[model samples]
Target: MLIGDVARRSGVSARMLRHYESLGLVRPTGRSEAGYREYSSEDIRRIFHIESLRSLGLSLREVGLALDDPGFTPSGLVDDLIRQTRERIAAETELLTRLRRIDAAEPAGWEDVLRTVALLQALGSESAGKRQRAALSSAEEGPVPVEALAEAALSETDPNVAGALRWALARSGDTGLPLLAEGLGSPVAEVRRRAVQSIAEIPGGAATALLRQALTNSDVVVRRSAALALGTRGVANAVPTLIDMIVEGANDVDAADALSALASDPASTDQIATGLVGRLARGDVEASARRRLTQALADIPGTTTSRALADLSNDDDRAVALTATYLLTLRGAQ
Candidate 1:
């Protein structure tokens, strides 16, 4: 077969075949009577082989080494090719993500598109200041796409930057909740915590519902954050986790305050007080936890809290008894 037939049969362009010949990767065995290049079967096979190696992302020189070097080992070169291919794929994927995010922003013009792209690049910047600025400017830069904010929030290590991203997501309303909720399911504990924290800041019944659902998350941090947010929102469902926080001494002061806030509802006051008292009554309750629980009771009013406080006043632990006594005296004066 001549170059034309080879090009037709093997799909390697004639010009590329000549380039391959020029590179010494392939050569025809003989010339036609007209002095045109003619390829024998072996040369045709060699041409196919060159195409095969080229398909593996081999540079022309590497392909030459692969085909000509008697001592060349495939394992190392193949591994290198695999790594390069993976890198290329990752680059393409990142570019696709940027394009999709820009499309989602629905830029009004080229300037809007550029601003969104710049903000996205800044959001991923190594400088925490840039990341924070990008996050703060996202809303002003034409809705910088919630996915970008959620992704940054999930991975952000800088506290100030993370706060700005959370604030941006909150300003986005509930649009980012689904992504943040997905973040909650991430195996990374920090991501899950950030997810719940961001979700908690969003102002909507939807966020409140997600926080309530997150109360059962397997991650203790997620459960705690969700519980605290729900407590502030007056969701009675957080009562159990809030009470547990008080007992475990994990952010117990905030937990106690949340419980106190929930206690203002006449209907939930007794329920909240009872949950606190039950933890206090547990035989396994530690001295410190019992004291914290007793202190928490100071904010809950009504006969249930007053009675629990009276019972706790005589407890064996002197500190617990003192705290309960102090609370009861105040209760009586009211």
Candidate 2:
């Protein structure tokens, strides 16, 4: 068949077919008398194999090497792909676990999250040598029993379950936000806080709005959680509300947390730097708030904070002097 016919059949473009040929990944069996490339049924089969391998996250180079292997088996390739997918899923779950811990305030809950994280680390270490043994053992046993193991794993009340759920929601933020947003209005403060925390980890406009709405929760903890979540999104629109909460709010810890979140976001770092510098110049802000705000600004990268810190170097206030020194340390300027 012609290149166009192969493209139509395989859903791959002719340009990609030529590129694959140039890479030695595919070749035409022969050329017609008219000088057009001719493909065989075997060629189409190889193309489909390449596409499937690519979908499994294998690089073209790796796929080519695997295809060239005399001992390569279909089952072996499927097992490898499944293993790779599981590893990626595990890594994402671990990251989400850490994020949830950071967002959690209660010592007991945070410790539980930490323990799960440690277990995941240990599992990775222990599994490295066992995977090949397990694969070999599975071949002798006739089937891997993956479905049974997955069912058993899912039925357990593991602390890592929350991490896995949070990870899934983060990856599927578009689909998860509605459920999370609804949870924010739940009667339980803990549920509302978790919802806020999960939404904060997801970056999107709807998540931002959900967090903003959460700021109105009657419970102080819920309100603080929402403020922290909004800070993660770092939209300019949330700045005024966060600043108001910090400036007038009685909860010093929550205010400081919100400021830290705002400062960590690169988008809000410049504004945070300017606000902190203005407060320092006026000498009206509380000492603790000023200290936290200055440190937060210095922690974020960019030229804006550097220049702002340079201007503060001459300030007589002890907190300003300390923050300036910290900023200078970041620049390796002593």
Cα-based RMSD of candidate 2: 22.8
TM-score of each: 0.95, 0.40
| lDDT for 329 (candidate 1) | 85
Off by over 4 Å in 2: 1-159, 171-173, 202-204, 230-234, 240-270, 281-284, 299-311, 326-334
Question: What tens digits encode model 1's per-residue C-alpha lDDT throughout 1-334?
Answer: 6789989998889999899999999998888889989999999888788878888889999999988999999999999999999999999999999999989888899998999889988998999999999998888867477889989998999999999999999888888888888998998888898899899899989999899889999999999999889888889999999999988999999999998888888888988988988888889988888888889989898988888888888899999889989988887787
Best by TM-score: 1
**How well is each residue in 205-280 modelled by candidate 2, as lDDT tens digits?**
7777877777777766666666666665555445554555555544545555566676667767777666655655
Q: RMSD in angstroms, all models? A: 1.5, 22.8
Model 1 reaches what TM-score against the true structure? 0.95
Candidate 2 TM-score, true structure as reference: 0.40
Candidate 1 Cα deviation (angstroms), residue 181: 1.1
